[model samples]
Target chain A: MATKLARRRSKAAAFGVFNPNHVVGGRVAGLIVAFWTAIALLLWIASPWKTLPTPPEVIHALHDLWWNDGLGPELFTTLKLIFHATLITTVLALGLAYLTVVPAMRPLVQAASKLRFLGITGLVFPLTLLTGGGYALKVALLTFGMASFFVTSMAETVLEIPRSEFDHMRVLGASELLIVWEVVVRGTLDRALEVLRQNVAIGWSMITMVEGISRAEGGIGALILNENKHFRLEDVYALLLVILLVGLGIDALVGLLRAVLCPHARLGKVRR
Target chain B: MIPGASVGEVVLDVKEVGLTLEEHLILDGVTFQVKDRIREGITTGQVVALLGPSGVGKTRLLRIIAGLDAPDSGTVRGLQGEELPAGTVGVVFQDYPLLRHRTVESNLLLAGSIGGLSAARSEARTQELLKTFGMEDRAGFYPGQLSGGQKQRVAIAQQLVVPRRFLLLDEPFSGLDPAALEDVSKLICEVANLDEFNTVMIVTHDIRAAMAVSDTLYMLGRASKNGKHVPGAKIVGEYDLVDRGLAWQKGIMERPDFVALEHELRGLFRTL
Candidate 1:
């Protein structure tokens, strides 16, 4: 019995330490560190400067831009556009999805599906002619480019909620509208948020395209376009880095919200 | 709890109900009566177990009674000839079908709101149910965080958030551990006995669970003679619990009378 106990103990020791609680946290930290290191290496190699901007130099550049160039307002404008676009997409997508399930409104949903193939960039001429430059044009471009996918993806998410859930709500005395609110909306909210996070990058790309064409007074896209025209390679690279950082930050914030709202989703290994 | 409805009376009747799917008859002239049973102001709620083998149309029969699927002929009524109000019959589906994104407490609140309860009433009922099902600690947890037993309890509790005329549990004991099965059966007994619940019908193949908690037993099986394909299956036997006073008591299965009754129930199934 003693030999058996010793053998078991040795086997456990050989297998290595196991801290089940911290495994997920440790792995996530390692991944983040590795990712940042790879980005820094790429930036260092690509820089034309004799002395590449080290981590400190990049941090200083971020600080310099924020204070001297009205970068704060530009960043805020870009963020505001993306935020509203996501909000509009969420509401409109959910509404379209709700209507799709209704027999009377199903044809309207079918008609909306055709928008999936409608190209936003191709509509630039008419959009500029109708809405014209500045905020309206930007929003219209972003909405037109992204709303169709959002609506279809959200509708599919809503549809995929098992029919049994709808039946459960009905038997519990819920009306058709009530089922739409409870079973359909609450059921799809987290998934819809995830889809928005995935599609926001596409929205960002569209924002850049629109800004480049129309020359907005402010926004990161305008900053990038201005930097590009002057051939300020360092400034352009720095602005791109800023864009990448801000995008990641926003995605992380949305992920945090998802963690809070749907705690069981366990979306990330990193501990809150 | 709905106005104009009386407690301690027959609330649901499935009379000569026939259902067919794609030319395959599922329930043929299936009939059952559920009376609200109360003792000393505590509903001893009548648990009528619908015992049947797989593919014997138990689920289809349940759907018909819940009014989710229309029967080809005959009638299913609540409060005599009056149609059941929207929330009269709450069904706990076999898989629980919980809103995965919402916390346990919010799920109950959602159900209450859909049932037209006031905000204050919904909040009160949500807390009450969370406590009743021994899930107060898990109120903040989402469905994905729960064990099978906890999910099952929440599913049933959400249905009861609004006082229902009848509660239908589909295969409630399918995947429970022995201890969990015991706990769930006890909960069913306790909840059914509440004045708010008139009748609780459980569909299960687990005779032990049925024998432990149900006051009435119903067995359903295919009746094709000599291995022929029967078009439909019907109720085979019904047993009253009045004679077996100790059936609900723990370890009742070890009792001679309980064992004898279990044998008798198995005998009916064997003949099918």
Candidate 2:
């Protein structure tokens, strides 16, 4: 009976792509990833379109961009801008979201969240006039672009919190301010991290456009625009790849931070 | 064998409490009182069960008592004989909500601090409660890592960390297996015996489980008069197991009288 049970367990773990509630082992999962990669490579090699840059060309362009074109500094500038914008967005968005607990602040928060629907192109002129159109403009544009999304997600996180949690805090003799601190601020910190992680991607995607508005401080966005204008398709593709890799790295870092700071966020159903 | 139990002055009084949501009467004229239970000169606490079928306003009534929700009519009086103030009563929700971002220890510590414990005292109380709940080893574990039963234990312990006189549990025995059910029953009894002023009101549909752990049982359902069903739920039945020689008895389920009462309550529950 023991051997039969073991055999059943092993079989169940071996292949479970189509099975609900069945998780494949690490080896099986790795194999599945490799299979998809192989198929993607074959498709890339066989594509009829020749205008797309080949892998070898893209790699050579990457080497040139790194060695001669100051891609390193440009990338650094973009990252720095992202860091500042994210810091400001975090403060502003969180303040607005947390203040929603007060009846008077809800309409203002709702207005801020609704600003996400407004296009950045229309607001760029006004923002440039407001910030005098320099590095300040870049940072302002990025912050403006990101804060609405951050507020939207963070506000939803606060709203979705079960009423019972607030009640639980009240029962613990928590005052209204303490309840906000415990249930809203501290309770949603991990979720805030997750929301930040998601919005950082949006920041990355928008940086190039924001940088175009004020080209005094050169960033990857400015570099991409320069390359694209010159019809340097290979360099453009290489810069795109660089952005992808950097975005993935930032994502991994945020995930690591969440794991360390909120280790409980990752845990799910440990079978005794 | 009887544990020398005696009832004292009422600590909680609900008089003519009524609620209406969207033109539908949920609870009307729901009145009851929980008195201090003294045994051998120690306040061993009293466990009261609020039993009813689903959607019978059991949860709503519990909320009103905890001051989380306000009833349209009537008032809930606390030990001071005034309107029950927010933070005066502790509540354990049916889903056993805990801070998912925090470890069990951090969650308890926060509760203690909210309960007005000093930092040093909060830490000591957290450690003690962790040990009491058999969660000392899992103190670093997150709520998501623990099973349903473990989360329930943490939820209960979170309340006790602050020395609350009253705790309300909604559906404490809903989804437990038999062994877990037995464990929770014992845990409820142990908590009740921890303090003389401590009172637990458990709202559940599980008649047998509630009967096993509670000294007082109240049923909520609509009354009938002159062949017409009443519009709202109220305290339709009340039983004092202490007077019936059934309170605080181990292996009470095996008693013939206990089985008979279970059958009787089961019949009464179907009517609700």
**lDDT for each residue of candidate 1 in A23-50, tens digit (9 for 90 to 100):** 3346656766898999978888686875
Candidate 1 CAPRI classification by DockQ:
medium
lDDT tens per residue, model 1, B31-56: 87766654553346667889987778
Report the C-alpha lDDT of model 2 over B93-166, residue by residue, as the tens digit: 98998888778998999888777889999999999998999999999888888899999999999988878778
* Native contacts present in each candidate (fraction): 0.85, 0.85
lDDT of 2 by residue, A32-102 (tens): 89999899878876768877787889899999999999999999999999999999998999999998898
Candidate 2 CAPRI assessment class = medium
Chain A TM-scores for all candidates read 0.79, 0.90
User: What C-alpha RMSD separates each model from the true structure?
Assistant: 5.9, 3.4
| Highest TM-score scorer | 2
Query: Clash pairs of candidate 1?
Result: A173-B87
- Candidate with best lDDT: 2
